[model samples]
Target chain A: MSEHGTTLNIEKFGSASEAKALSAEADDWTLIIRPQTGWFDLHLADLWRYRDLVTMFVRRDFVSFYKQTVLGPLWFVLQPLLTTLTFTIIFGNLAKISTDGLPKILFYMSGITAWNYFGECLTKTSDTFNANASIFGKVYFPRLSVPISIVISNLIKFAIQFGLFLVFYFYFLFRGSNIQPNSMLLMLPVLLLLMAGLGLGSGIIVSSLTTRYRDLRFLVQFGTQLLMYSTPVIFPLSSIPEQYRWIMIANPMTPLIETFRYAFLGTGTVSWGMLGYSAVATLVIMTVGILLFNRVEKTFMDTV
Target chain B: MSETVIQVRDLSKRYRLGVIGGRRLVDDINSSMARLLGRQDPLAKVDLLPGADKQKAARSDEMWALQNVSFDVEKGAVIGIIGRNGAGKSTLLKILSRVTAPTTGEVRVKGRIASLLEVGTGFHPELTGRENVFLNGAIYGMTKAEIRDRFDEIVEFSGFEKYIDTPVKRYSSGMWVRLAFAVAAHLDPEILIVDEVLAVGDAAFQERCLGKMEKVAGDGRTVLLVSHNMSTIQQICKECIMLKNGSIHKVGAPGSVVSEYLSETRVATNVDLTQWQDRTGNGFAKLSRMAFLNADGEEAGIFPIGTTICFDLETTYNRELIDPLFEVIIHDPAGEPLMHLRSEHDGLRIGKVNGRTSVRARVDNVGLYPGRYFVSARIAAGGRNVDFPRLCGSFQVTPSPGRHGDLRLNPKWGKYHLDSTWTRGDQ
Candidate 1:
């Protein structure tokens, strides 16, 4: 057999002194696996090395979502359009909640577009462990890649919905509505980044917790809904009473939605202070989420 | 000079027994709070608590899947890990692959390591074969550029070029396994950790996988293989490690280590088979005991060649069985079936059996080669298997004088001996 020929070559390595000499240089080892690592050891370089896996996961999520479906990516536009219509009818027209002087459809559509991105990212990433127990159980990659890919893939959906919002946005501007667009529109990318960060941060926290406490899986479904009301998604932040403003601002998602409307429709209140606070909150939450996620990932296979 | 690519030191992994989520969340919160406050864990056993009982706590909720196992593997060494069920074979592979973490100790590894704990680890059914190849490749730690460069070769190796664009869900099970194994086969890591993945697909594909592994080993890359199939272990591994009950039982050349493992697995005569949990079937009937008997109807551990060997199986049925068929399959030392003796094949089907029954299959003038052999017993009725206990018992076959009066029968000739008359034939 061919194996015997190879076996002969292997047997020649009988020099113990050489192996011992080489092993003395322990620093030459590339990877050291242990039971526990420091809490802050995020292994970001490993994550960077596995960036292609993130991209592949993103492509899988994006391509597989629309396969064999009649509408395909049109659903990306339709989803927010339908949700905006429902909000405009139920809240704007029927309930008579003020839209801060902007057109009811544009106001609701803008809020729905931004909220949908955060909502999708949050809900999808929150279930990363449960949804991927099969793959995670068998293979080892940076577990954060799954949640990071979710945030990115949802960005594509958010972009499509943002384009649809822009259609009506320009139509209203050409119609000479009182609405005004201003330089705050430059904060668009930063606003998306803040939203993505908050969603990813909070989502991973819930996912890490649900590895043991599965009740959070059920809580996340309604938790995102409750969080939406606290944020200025359907109503303008100005509608809140002065005493309750801090509560709304404390939601972290508030300034993102407020800045989105203020930038595009030039209606909702936008403050640099609140936006900075939102960004800091995102950073803090992201740090804690990553640390907790890193800690849980090592032994979640046992508990999960 | 050889360099150690993988050095594992005092590795141990502990798993909590019982339902994973059975612990109350209150207990978890308490433990975390205690840990944060620099206090002893409230739920910790008394034995672990200072000033508590010196006696060991009844920590029945904990199990050590692996315990203080240490070994080193040189560069380019093909190492095989063999063990029975619950022997920590998969646990070791999982730790090496980083799929799970150990409870203690450490493993230091050099070079790029890719582990194929199972084939098709992250295959998305909605994705086409081509997309899955890239996805599965990335999951195995390959870059998109690397997969792109080897995409044609991967598809060619899988022999699924025509179906590359077709969604993997539409492919048959064999095709899917082929594509998955194809991507795995192309992973050119410096150290490859494989766990029983060669048992997939058909024989030809398995041969291809073994060939690929041999080539990988020949490339001066290290490989760690975990498999239950002894022949595959003996054929591929230069060195073998046998684990028993989460500890290393033996480490040596494949031949001696494998024989030691086989000899240890040879159950004593009249072993209580009912306690064998690693069995498969509907459980309508169970084999309670199995004994190897000589021609004198006495329990025997050794049977000389060309003698009557009887396999006595004691079974208990839950209900009355109709037309039950019993089978005794003799396997060689390498765990490959050497002979299959089925009741139906011999036209000795029993009409009916009640509660407890003793079945016997006797063969006259057995011609098996002189070696250790394992017996797998099975009971079937009503067109389905009632019980199948694999490798449940074993016995020794010693060489004896053949019809031609040869004292020594060389096992290298074959697994069995045949009495043939040789005459001068007109050519």
Candidate 2:
């Protein structure tokens, strides 16, 4: 431990107001910075000092968006509900995409619900610097708190949407829509965690890059759109042709979507090998993302 | 006794001027592919040396924002950081506030810190002022309960009672600044750092903020303030640090540091305005130059408070134009306008001229704060035109022998300076 040196002897005199009045009366104004060797450096105490500020920023991100809307918190549920309806109409009915003979709404809703969480997190994380540069420039809090808050706030939205899926799932079961809860459903939390980790990880990585080239900004939207095709979002994993099955299975999201559908409908394929692969991929990507994010947050202002 | 809460050791931050570094998707893919084959990084085979600069045009040139800087801040000490533009004062404060990290060296500190590098900085424009206050407070590290406790005070301090529910985007710039400052000052933190935010808001608000900062510091908290206003800095800060370029030029007693800063960056009395090449507007009704003539009618460098003065402006009108409006705006050294003089309402035309024209304005008395000031003159061929070349020059106003604070006008028993007298009569 370092020994403390150069303690300032603060003479407890009067109230701050009294001191201010006395200073004004004395008519002596001064600006002082102690000449030393370590002014422009990182200070953890500063970040700890501003922890409350980080929390406030997190709350702001969470609450401000839905404050004025008519549906209010219900908007969260409505988002995935509407998206699930669209996917059911497009993939289940028109395209005749197979859901392994499960209820159309239930199959598509489960996939969309999980997929939406990842998409939202990734998109939000990718735009972190560009979206909040003005705020970041003006105040000093933990820079990571911004992206971290984005993930947390989006989690709340995901929870609400997920709850809506649950409600609809029970409705379909009650209506005899060929759905039954399975043992795989118990792993829902783990699958959701994987989705969040991968989305947040990739989002922050791209966000760090988008601050510089901005070319990635366009690619993020395009790539997300293309990446959706590779995942088992619309069609079941079994629908892929035999030769291309390995390529589809190689996607990190494949196990999440498959396990999610298998949990509720008990029809889609679920494999421990695929889940383990995704877990490894999630860990690797998250490590890379955090390292890159930590490095970028230090000097992104220069490039951004 | 106040303990040294923050210790920085040989900290320096260097930034690339125009470049990019780090891995791209291709790099990541290639690295992963190489690792699959048990090989070294593919790009490492090319630019393996530390000084290698020929690899890419993206990651070459750089500049140092903070170089070899060091300091220790004792708890409860209100230190002011000051410098001219681009002196790295903000950068130093930002680093201390932990918004960014230094490229070299380390910092050790104790306790919580909240920095308002800018007012209303973290505000979401779409959110109401009420929502923003909570959000901004949270960002500053306040708990929801803490924000709730201080919520009323923040709102009342801003004096935006009726507009609290309004989205911050709709609030005036003044309201925005006041609200932002209120949130920052009210956050109960062990260390508070602010950067030149006092320049916002009216005089009374600035005074109130200074008082609040004093109160915070008095409560055994550390404060780091960066501002250009010497008087404000001197009033609020006990010690001062003067930065030049990217390093500390001087530090210690605020009075001495401020004086040194002023002397080093001060514009010479005999400054030639003609050499400034950045003046806007073309030669068409262009203002070539401007100067301040003293009470003795001699061209002078400095003005005293409440001195009668004349502004001599030379303009080159290239087109045959009708009535042209000529105006002169006087701004304090910090770029705050003190007064603006214009040909009242109608345009003052030096009609149909293709040659140079000189104009003059005689004022009874010019009252201004004791500091350097800038004179920006404009000559528009017609009313409501600002694109024409305007004359802009800066001048200094030395503090009067007996005067104080920002405003120069002396008043007699009035709330504001309005050139009036008050008498106590039977109410």
Candidate 3:
């Protein structure tokens, strides 16, 4: 058994050295709570220990979202399908926007498939604090579990949407429509990681800010919609004016969508340098987001 | 040699008062700019400005929820934290549970800590009982394998095995509370922090919860509990901490600490109700003052058993009121209503009342046990509440020799005493 000796030191005051000396014998203490922790106090070990909670949250979200609905998980496939059809009609046919000689339906479906995952992760994770405030107020769990679970749960929906895209891609291929499947298609996992990273990174940053300034919630709602226009989701990046192409390239999501289309449809822009830049940007945002989120999680209970 | 399972040193938590969103972004920017320029905060409180005469800012916007509270919990000890509302009991528990960080000082804890600030912290209404059990268990930091091992025991304990597959939203509110409490009861952490979760469910369930808690305490885990129920605290806790105005007022054996707390609360009851802000009603009429009177109409604060007691309420109204029902409810120290006295129930009819009227309800024999009881008064007219004030005032009941002769009445028997006659029947 560990030592059970009682130590009383109520008279000691304003002595940082004594406190440090006590804390330095840290192997005996399972946890030491203080007023302010460093920015990098991410508590990754605690997060790992609470990984089951993250899985449970993901399960609850997936099961409860489609509980009574007749369509159920079918909505996951239908959502992207309907969105792709609408984009095909408005942006491709009516607006006279070129799909770079690829089939409009397949081109839009490919981009939508990739964009939907990032969009869902960003929008849902951004509301992590507000949506789970009641549970957060009552219990002490890794607050990051909620957003991380959201990203994972949305992956299931992404899979369903990706399967739908594959069905259409094969149908066009067997019909002799001009589409190429190439080695670049192996970048699918890396591209997915980049999207998840960018989404989670910016999502938590906004979630942390929203705890104090509620006005940011409204901004996030429309901000995602405005952001999709900058990416190559509805339109091809190659069609933009040469001088003005940098505007679209500035968005981290731009290269991700462009590369996803080029890999599958073999018609959109894909550059190693741009993809590398997007990867670097994701890393930076993720680091900043996690740090800000850690800082806010400790004290947001009071403000939120 | 008892181990100190938890040590809290100079722990304090400061909360900013007023609306959390009261300050605009412009004010935040201006303050940051001023701070960056090595000047005082531009938007700080007037007293906190550069030229303030006070040694400390003492900003009115700030309030310390917990101030310099230090204590240690030995393993196998059940410690009860008792205080009035806003006395910082919850804040102390919150800090210890890590729901929020303290503003200063530190707390070092050994072993795993599971805090049940509420019974069903993460119970989703749409999930089935069985699913929620696993979910709630995981939320309490239990793994899936651990939950699976004890899932049967949990289901049987909740007495919801038949309804285990049904969604929680479909269950009755009582069933939901039972299921939630069952999950909480099975948490076997080294340190258990509970905050008034025993107040939920029915009386029998509360008893079962207390029994479970006793078993937990008996298992030699460190338990920290916050509750207003003095009896439970005194019965379960070997030691008690009394909090007053965000600081520890006393810490000792449960019996003495509870009595001290009760005595202090007795003195804190307000006699004048006009300025009491904690009230709810439509506000057509208001209760101003309350006085306890004896049989001879003499003002008194204490009355012995079997004696006539009257509660006189001084009331005021802005306009004439008709057929107003005057009601008074007596509650025990735990805020549980023991008796209700209503004019309508007694068939008393008051035709009309104007501004500044007094109402009195007289009891022929005050059969209450000897202890302090609070009064909640309400005046209703035309199917609507004119005024309602809860715990407006308190009075004491003293023990007296009744038909039982020299045996004093024990409050543990119950809150009321009934007149009875015993006789031998011829066979």
Q: Clashing residue pairs in candidate 3, if any?
A: none
lDDT of model number 1: 0.86
Tell me the TM-score of candidate 3's A chain.
Answer: 0.92
lDDT of 2 by residue, B158-204 (tens): 88889999988898888888888888878787878877766677777
The number of the candidate with the highest DockQ is 1
lDDT of 2 by residue, A216-265 (tens): 78899889878888999889999989899999888898888888888888
TM-score leader? 3
What's the true lDDT of residue B368 in model 3? 87
By DockQ rank, best first, the candidates go 1, 3, 2
> Per-residue lDDT for B1-427 in model 3, tens only?
4666688888878787643653455567888999999998866665434442222225656666777788777788899999888788999998888889999889989999989999877898889999999999999999999999989999999997899999999999899888988898888888999888667666688778889888999999988889887878987999999887677777888989888887776653337888887888888889888778889998876788889888888889878889899999999766789899998998978888888888789998888887778888888999998888898777777788877685466555567888888898995
* Each model's DockQ score: 0.39, 0.21, 0.38
Better of 1 and 3 by TM-score: 3
TM-score of chain B of each: 0.81, 0.74, 0.90
**Residue ranges of candidate 3 with Cα displaced over 4 Å:** A1-27, B19-57, B268-270, B294-303, B406-413
- Model 3, A1-304: lDDT tens digits are 0011112225222244655565566459899999979998999899998999999999999999899678999999888889988998898889979889999999999989999999999999999999998888889988999999999999999998999999999999999999888888999999999999999999999998888777788789799999998898888998999999999999999999999988888888889999999999999999999999999999888875
Which one is best on lDDT?
1
